[model samples]
Target: MRRYTARLLGFLAVSAIAAFIGAGAYVYYGGYDTSALQQHSEPVYRVLQYVRERSILARSDFDTPDLTSLDWQHAGLMNYETYCRQCHGAPGRAPDSFSLGMKPAPTAIAELARKRSPQELYEVIEQGIKMTGMPAWAYRLNQAEMWQLVALVKQIANMTHADYDNYLVQAQEESPQQTETRPRRSEEIASATELPTMEGLSRIDAGRVAMQQYNCTSCHMIPGVTAARNQVGPPLGGITQRSYIAGLLEYSDNNLIKWIRFPTTVDKDTLMPDLGVSQVHAEAMLAYLKSVE
Candidate 1:
């Protein structure tokens, strides 16, 4: 009986190896088509979509905030226009020609906004689907701003075509070419806390303010913020003590600066988005982070 069991196990192991080798050969030899225009068959597309949706649902544990009543629709509208309108048509617009050619074309987001809850939709925004053109903006935006974007989506989903067009005009008027564009007087765009200069304040104090504004606390356990019990990112209590950043780069000012200013450049698949942080801001934040040790 023991000898029979060993023979069966060896047979299964060999079969597994053979299957792996066959798959590798097929891929390496171009048995799979890699054309963008070659759309996946219905079954393949459905399966991929199911996996993406489930993955988003599994990770979206955040409580949906009070977004319905908030005057965030305007900010959300701008965000939609800037980040999404090109790929997913707005209420009165059509998606661009290039976006329509892609396989599994971007969904009409107004319909999507109506179908999914705010939390579910935010999951898609915060952690973009893999292998899809959709990229995560968590690194670029704060939690408050994200909520406003969501609010705008919900509002647009219910708006008449004329209302949406009117909205675009309004948003355009408010958007100064050089300065930041945000929703009407929401906390997200309220002038940065009237804090002292980075040099006048302790680095920790300055870093804390930057972190708060950037919504770092949403993903990381910042030392002093009350709402920083985050689990998505590594806690930053001993960030400076570590010898590496993201376990890939050597720990140094230049590396840290790059990581902060352009996290996606450091790692292509990183969830961190570019915030367009200035060199001076990153340097100051690094000083505070290093001091936290």
Candidate 2:
């Protein structure tokens, strides 16, 4: 019995090691295509869908607002036109050509609305799904605006293309300025500088959210953030221990804030753009950077 048990353990250990080595080789050899043009395999797609659904279900503990009012629905319609239509498409419309190219392409919003509860929709709109090109709108849209978006989504499934067009026309007439133009990036950055203090979140947490909002991960590899592996700039894992900011300014809270808000002023030759980070947000970002090590 002892001999048999010893043999069984040895086989299990060998199998585990072999599986690990195979996985490593597969990764190292680039066994899978990662281009957005390539779709996920059926098994991988199903697994990801399952995980996404479960994650949403687990976190969708929101209390739905009274979304039955026409006022709320109209507000939702306008917001949808501004923020959602480009990616998710509308009744009798297709998503933008660029969005159609996304791997695991943006899901049909009408279908999602038809199947999911209001709370589920709200959570998705507010928090966003990671790695799926969905952005968390919490930083951009206020609570009421997000809830209004949910209200619009709830009504989308029933609307035909004509119905949507009619509603959109009415919404446009009601709020001409709201849907007529989108805010520019410079305006957005300037507004961020003047943003009121964020409630509930710690400084570091707020900073992390600010990092995402500012698209910092597109250039710098920040610890504890996803899709932050771009090598355009230096990795920030040990930024706190580093002697300098942007290899010019000495590392300190004031210097870091100045660099973050006005990178061009600090280094005219550097590629880093001035993101107009707020003093509060800069401090928050600094706190997160210091804590990373």
Candidate 3:
């Protein structure tokens, strides 16, 4: 009887090893096609579907924090245009061709958003999943911006194309102008020259306040400025440190200003708007942004 029991245990162990070997072989031998153009197999598709549902359900249990006065819709619109629209697309628009090639292709969040709670959305934005094109945003954005994105995702489900365009217009209108010639008071210029020592509050903090006041954080993911973990536009964490403005333009104050003022001319497909930023305010904001390490 003891011999029979030992043999049974050995059989079980051998069976487990065989199963592991077979699964590994199938994966390593390229038995499955991984092209995005091809539909996922039943098992793979079911796993992804389960992950999507379960992750949302598990993360949704947390209490959503208060953001009573924040106008996230405006912030989201700008973010969407700057970062998300190319991949996720807006109402009546389709995602770009390259986005379609992504293995799990970026979904139009506007349609899928109704099913997720705010916290779930936030988790996805902040943590990001492995082996997916999605990037983890915790390192690049602050908590407030992440929450703003959650709010925007929730609101996007019912928005129309016109509504999105109108919000974009509002964001553009809020951008500071570049041509105003206000005389700097002597004291202000002297203080500026002295480079008032910054403490406790970082440039990021000041930028955050400026973002909120100007509604810049309402749209794009301004790293260190807002708390949203959105990928709506390229992260703005090290904009000042970049050696180039866009991928093509050489980085310079003039180039940055020109890009900000005339994004369309720089790149016809560029989504950035002429925000009408005045020269002085733009310079101040740029200085603050560049100061960020």
Error of 1 at 16 (Å): 1.9
**What Cα-based lDDT does every candidate model obtain?**
0.72, 0.80, 0.64
List ranges where model 3 is wrong by over 4 Å. Answer: 1-4, 176-293
Task: Kindly list the per-residue Cα lDDT of model 3 for residues 1-293, writing each as its tens digit.
Answer: 99999999999999999999999999999987777679888898789978877876775676777654556766555555555667778776777778878877776878657876777787777666655677654433446666777777777788887876676677767743412323222222222321211223455454444444344564567656645565655666688678887687998878876775567889888667655444443455566667664
- Judging by lDDT against the true structure, name the best candidate: 2
Residue-level lDDT for 39 in candidate 3: 80
lDDT of 2 by residue, 14-105 (tens): 99999999999998999977887788889999999999999999988857668885355577787787788889999998887889888778
Predicted structure 1: clash tally: 1
| TM, every model | 0.62, 0.81, 0.55
Q: Candidate 2 or 3, higher lDDT?
A: 2
lDDT of 1 at 197: 31
What local lDDT does model 3 show for residue 158?
A: 83
Error of 3 at 107 (Å): 2.4
Question: Which portions of model 2 show Cα errors greater than 4 Å?
Answer: 69-74, 183-200, 221-231, 234-270, 274-280, 290-293
Q: What lDDT, from 0 to 1, does candidate 2 have?
A: 0.80
lDDT of 1 by residue, 211-234 (tens): 665667778886766683887889
